[model samples]
Target: MKKYAFAASAATIALAVSGQAFAQESDAFSTALADGAVTELAPVTVTTPLRRPTTVLQSTSTVTVITEDDIEKSAAPDLPSLLKRYPGVNITTNGGQGATSSIVLRGASASQTLVLIDGMRVASATSGTAYISNIPLSSIARVEIVEGAHSAEWGADAIGGVVNIITKDGSTCENGASVCTTVETGVTYPWGGYGTVSTRGVSNSGVNFNIGLSLLGTEGYDFTTADNSVHEDGRDGFLQGAFNFALSKDFLWGRLYTSGLYVRSNPHFDSAPYADWMTGETVYGANEADQTNAAFKVGAEVDHSDTWSSVFELYSAFDYQKNFRDGHPEADTHYDTNRYGLSASTTKEIQAGAALNTFTLGAEAYRETVDSSVEYTETARDVAAVYGQYGLELDALTFNAGLRYDYDEQFGDAVTYNVGLGYELVEGLTARASFSTGFNAPTFNDLYWAYDGSYVGNPDLEAETSKNWEVGLNWAPTDTAAIDLVYYENRIDDMIAYVSDPVTYIGTMENIDKAKVSGVRATYSQMLFDDRLGLDFGFEYRLPKDETDDVYIANQNRLKLTAEASYAATEKLNLNAGIEYVGSRWTNADNIEYTNYAQYQLGAYTLVNLSAIYAIDETANVKFAVENLFDEEYQTAYGYKAPGTTVTLAYRRTF
Candidate 1:
């Protein structure tokens, strides 16, 4: 019955698309389809905010868009490196490429940020976090970051914000039947070699498709050193591969699309006792770890009437990981997770007393399952949510309000809401304010896993909840310059943490903490010298504290500053440079006892990077980059040492 219902729904959407094609034609839709050739600086449409397509300038929330040109100019090796340049964003890595990386946005925990690929959630259900390190930049076309609570639109894990990645599509090519291919290869010391190949094309009938593949291998250095010794651990290594595909077609009604992404990586690290805080123990064994992440989605859109439009999609995602020590079968561990989802949304435009109003309604349903070697109290859960949003625009004043209700099999019910207001103070200045509520459900591992006596889960844990508010000002004084300033505060209750029982010293997940995070972020950018030179600056000051203990939050930097400058020396030559500063952080010492934790601080550091791209012609280019330009030694974590100065050289050819 369920299969039949799904098939019926898909058929209905296809028929709607066909019907709309015969009804009427819209120039707006045609312009949108042709926007693929537009410049990056132009206003772009995004759908993550309200589950309805809207221009960035029309959004009431603070947002940032990173385009393909920005990614190419940055010359970053991974997603973390590229994201570090943005304000209100922070990244920490255990080692080099393919290592475990964490992203903290606006003082929010790594798991609090919702990540999406092509409008489909792709994080691990057990861990409640996404392995963005495995995603290849070669396959990405753009990224949209909305900074604030977003549970009103997304059900869970949206306390910090949403990161939506859009991959390349064939529509990016010129009109008529066209095909394009790109190949790039590069090398950095210690890291042996990396290469990528991607192809995309568009048919005369408006059918578009794209495919990309990438591979990377590296002989990495030790990630950590001995507790009280100068000697470093053994060398770690990894090999990773990623693949992506996208297809789309434009009909009279709207556009229909399907996409998929797959990533596989194998990384080796030092084994337990050797890497652990123990004296006189030489590193002998290496642990092998394998990970795979995959996602697939199919969707369709259509215009029912001049004032009404709708979108429908079905998606599935899979995440798997396995670890082995010294190739011993007895010392093997594995975890696998899968998610299947269906969603639909509609937008309606109306006129009311000289004001224009837009209304959006959406519903989503998904089932998630986890399979692991270790026993779990519960292996699967179902979740369903319905949401609605309304926006009113009158002269220079804009107002938006939204609400969502979610029901989960494991955790009864949750309701969240958001309200926002925007006022145009002047021709070039705008003031905005927003208030929102967020919630995060406990992960499967946190609620049901039973690994050992030392580590256990608690099924009685409550959902973490938060209240957030922010105010901001945006000023574009001139065509070439713009500035943004924002201040935000977030208060979280029933925060989840790992706590140990005093009697047995067994660790389990608990809601025994609270946090208050407040911060100010500012960004400024300007283009000078006939648009030949560009300068951008960002500053952030965060005060993230644990209210339960009146102590600073662990692993969060209090202050951050970033600056970048780019110059088009000529039409064929371009130069770019950037600097980033991360403030001090507090964390427990490596050897601290679980019962009696001790805090330690790590000092701040700054890094510089430079890159240059010389175009051989319209179809080819060469790039040179230097990371950690000054070779300053630094550590984001207590024992982990960051990479030193490294150079990368690459050539890109397009046909």
Candidate 2:
């Protein structure tokens, strides 16, 4: 590990100033810094704070931002790959590219994290998890991640945190119409090649559109070899396509904007059932899964007075999935979900004695419907909520308070609250603390799905609730350097889990007594060498446990560390590298009895990746990247093997 760090540092220094005369380009360097060439702290309009736009520094939350530049420079193959390096995030993929992946935030369950695309919640109603594997990087502009319970602001499934993906919009265009296209090709070790093509553009009239298509096929290696299973030995592949459009227009009284997205993916996987963990017998023939997601949103912002503003939005989204085996429908099973939402919010600002205050009030109503081949007691549900928040800002102190009440058709009603405070400790340092409550309703499958012999749903299950508290410090010692540290503890009650009957040995959804989760996260970023070099480091230690029985949580790492560096080696060439370390974790063995559960530990591993980009001209650029440079073998799950060394080459053009 030390040698890897030294090599990365040496490479960055040697490539950054190889033949350039440092003194001769002082004026150019200054101009570059002034022209936004250097990465600096920029204002972020985050809504997770209080369901209203607020700057990152002013909000009492831990946040991470992934910009367009970061995405482009990362050279990641998918959205999950790009997000895995961020602090407080962990990703588990069952196989190779285009595989089923799950994201865990701050050691929370994958279903506990809320995922939003352009202010619209997009997840499966039955599973309560988003398919991030299908989201193409070509259609995204930026991503904002808030790490902590936020149910007080956004009701339901927010016990872990919020991930808001902002897609590219026409407003990004500066002056005239611009067209951009990208082509990528890559290969996995001992497998096949993958290719992708995408085109995006923005018209001068604030109309933007994007279209992307990708194909990935691999003679995949057996991922279950770790468990001595030879059930699956065939190739796996996937095909995906995505489209996005957005339009905005300014009026005398307000602004109106609308956007839509559609994505489809078909991926092949093994037919082996999870219950046959150690069995080496082959299962069914080749299997494939199809999934589709579509969403549309329209909204308007109006200014009523100098101190008042209002917003109204309407949105609808849907998801559909189906599976097939050997070209024949399997179980005649398919799951389709639809959601519709309407919301309105207003902000009022007032001047008080020696202080300024802002108050926000909002109401939202949403309906979720599930149409599945599997029998269910209930197929549809509705939720309605009203929330309010107040903020006070003084010379060096800031305070916030919020409350929300939610009424569910199936679960009755729930109330949540949050309070926070921030004070300036010194000239360049600030201290902040917050306490919040969260809740997560049982999913349709968890509550209403009919008995399946092995498992059954329990409509009597109650909603899970959580309380969280955290304290943090933010310090910017210099214009080019910043550091953030946070310590947090979270307690959850009535956690949903599967329990088995002792006599019948039948599994059913139930609420666990309680769970305790705690963690500390720290991040540091600095700009060096006349703004030509960038360095970022992050570390997190988490203890997520099931307190009821002192059982270890599955697939949750205890420690995570990430380091990254980038260098603008020349006017047209750039180099970037990153390394990540995931500590040991525990997982349960398959078919284990509920009372005598067996767990196994997976050792820690480190991975390294490097990328280079060269600008051919103002309109064209090429990139090369190597993933898993060290070819380290590791597993996020007990029976799955992670990918190894691979290479990707891409070309992008703008006109």
Candidate 3:
């Protein structure tokens, strides 16, 4: 890492004395820095993963950070909306901001992605997933996304990746003050407009306070291509608040933190005609859904010593949804979940020759309680695990190994492990490889979601476990140019899915025996013209094999490509643009054949986004952005159309 500083400093001096011209240059350097330049340092450290600072590149797993500067430049409305800019992430949204947002990584479902707020799990055990839309983007300091399985080190709900949201802390204020405040307001157009206001301040007593409220209304587009049909379109608002306090700094110090969210939305899903199947009658009906979500999290972290730490966290979340279809009574669905856990770990670093060897050991236990009325399933279970990690540096090579054993009342026992090896092949080149295993317990809904006389519930179901292998190479041709290539393969045993009896229309969760997913990614970035301009390009490809003798899934894309560029044309001016292309794929769930289908292909679409900002003095600036420049009509969800032609104009002032 010291070598990186030396290289960056030398390049900075050259760029400072030179001048260049380019439309835009893009890379991690541009998006990760506070002012689009690594030379101008910020008070916050650059490598914090979740809540603590550490070397990012040397981590056992891949970590990608989206700084506050990146979010402000891109002008994304929420966290889920911003993740699409990263490599190897697939996002699906029902509509604009605060909507149903889902993420798929390495061919795994949205539920496989574990979301964390300052290292504590935010996923709902009842539905077995996180309602990402409920998470406000206002007070977030940074986001650290660690990609890939981490059951060995992170415990459950980590099969795909971990999205850790690190909120703003008291130290972010000026002069290390005990009190500070910040407020921002913005608007957008669609149905009605939108407005938001949020504030954060700290007390000299090591306490922090934050509150946010937003109101937005939209007169959504038509459900179909009809002249006078306004099926269902409405507006919604959200309120979120959080508080954190730190006690003394002695042996028995204490800390408390809490956050709550509330939202109300009316979304249209499908079209229906009014009629009675058993009786002849003329009726008028509409398709509409009203949904609400309320969630809260509380946690405390205690540091017992220089080498020991312990944390206890608890969370509760609830969701209610009702739908009206074709002149019938509203169908209601309710989901509630409770989660609690405690973790304790110790880290020891000892001098070994000329280097340091680190060892870590920890134990954790958590419980999930889920209840769903329509699902007709009630389940409760607790899970406990113990893990250890060893890291050592020998000559030019670094090695990391971890192991964990977990026992669950509902899923029996499982073992997870990981091993990583890295070697500095040359002065500017490095090679690395890692092997790990992960597991995901079946969700209650997947086991038992029933309707009418049909039901699906397999009491005896095995957890899905995956074995993954990855090898990668990183190269730096010069001080300002870096490139990387990685290949990964994942295989799963006893994957669970819904199986149905054709005659009875009854479905049951069953093990699929085997499934395989493999992929590769290539990324390149460079600072051109002596570091005044930047450019970044990357591509990812994935292929999933069912491996089940009786089933097949279609509509899976084999490739995704992303390109971004940023330019600091002048000391006071900055501009950026990004383009993404997602390949076409199929969408069939079962091997059984059906006639007269359009193959359900989502056409390949290209999206272009632009941003420009000019600094006014030192405390104020004007900004502008245009999203979906071409107004491309695309659908990430099966039948839902994405937003189009959004323009934003705003101003910012820093005190």
Top candidate on lDDT is 1
Candidate 2 worst ten-residue window by lDDT? 19-28
- Model 3 lDDT per residue over 552-612, tens place: 3454566788776667666677777878788866556654434754335667888887877
Give a tens-digit lDDT track for model 1, residues 440-470.
8899989998858688888898788889999
Candidate 2 local lDDT, residue 72: 71
- What is the lDDT for 638 in model 3? 51
* Number of residue pairs clashing in candidate 2, backbone atoms closer than 3 angstroms, sequence gap of 3 or more or interchain: 0
Order by TM-score, highest first: 1, 2, 3
Clashes of each: 0, 0, 12
Q: What C-alpha lDDT values do all the predictions have?
A: 0.75, 0.74, 0.60
| TM-scores vs. true structure, each candidate | 0.89, 0.88, 0.83
Candidate 2: lDDT of 527?
63
The better candidate by TM-score, 1 or 2, is 1
lDDT for position 305 in model 2: 83
Per-residue lDDT for 218-314 in model 2, tens only?
5655555424343466566667777777777766687888888788888776666444356875345336778888888999999898789999999
Q: Which stretches of candidate 3 lie over 4 Å from their true place?
A: 1-53, 174-179, 206-217, 222-329, 448-452, 549-555, 590-595
